[model samples]
Target chain A: MHRKLIESFGIRVRQCREKRGWSQERLAEYSGLDRSYVGEIERGRVIASIVTVQKLAQALNIDLADLLTNCGPPSGPGRSN
Target chain B: MHRKLIESFGIRVRQCREKRGWSQERLAEYSGLDRSYVGEIERGRVIASIVTVQKLAQALNIDLADLLTNCGPPSGPGRSN
Candidate 1:
């Protein structure tokens, strides 16, 4: 479940960034994160800290709740709100 | 801004736990995290990783978005969804 959630989150991040026409490097610059780290996050190879997530949200100009809730299709019944 | 956000997150966690009549130790147990760590999170002395936040959300029986959004009174105008 955790792995699935992380993967979904990565996909969400990628979609959001792409929606803004921002490159991984551009997002890294805006979020004060490493480009490679952002790539890894988008690939679901890494899980970010809450601070990092907040930075990404701020850079994307989205609310934190929106980032988490609208990441993908609704999660499974037992796993979601 | 980061500090304030963390503090608000902590307060939200505390309120959620209390509403369930669960002790810090119990929340820690359910989340598979350490009691002291939970305390630190509640005190806003630590910033948790996304995975940890998810664990806390699951333990609290709340959605991740709700945990992040409903933690405190609405954030300032510049903040919040």
Candidate 2:
């Protein structure tokens, strides 16, 4: 898997899950993923499939776009639109 | 490919690329992706690899997180952290 994106995604999964006051076990159940797999995502040990990502996004009620872009902040923070 | 995410990504790639004043060919070159593939992304025809997503994020000087989140705004749009 691409290391940076994987790692970035891990951090996000953890941050979002924790923000929701859910433990790994709860999140795993809520996201319909394995607990160990959730841990893997949190640890940056795996790059999730699109279905998995959608499950996670759905479980969290967040747009999939939020998961991809919020690592730190944009360097060029200007709106091109 | 997860159809929704891929299609969502296509729209985003198109919106962002145009916002940057980049042509499909220019974005393809800038992102180190093929022009046809860039078009695929713009048109939501395929899902990109992590490497491809990274390249596009880099070329846009935007955070990967931004790409994932900015889909029509979050329902609640609150900060967890």
* Candidate closest to the true structure, highest lDDT: 1
Candidate 2 iRMS, in Å?
3.2
RMSDs, each prediction? 9.7, 10.6
How would you encode candidate 2's per-residue C-alpha lDDT over A1-81 as one tens digit per residue? 368778888898788777666788887887789999999988998767555777776666665656654423221322111
Deviation in Å, model 1, residue B10 alpha carbon: 1.0
Go through the candidates in order and give each one's C-alpha lDDT: 0.79, 0.69
lDDT tens readout by residue for model 1, A1-81: 788778888888898888776899988988899999999999999987778888888778777777766743332332211
Q: Estimate each model's TM-score.
A: 0.84, 0.62
TM-score of chain B of 1: 0.85
Q: Model 1: DockQ against the native?
A: 0.54
| Model 2: per-residue Cα lDDT over B1-81, one tens digit each | 368777877898788777666788887887788899899887877767555776776676665656544423321322111
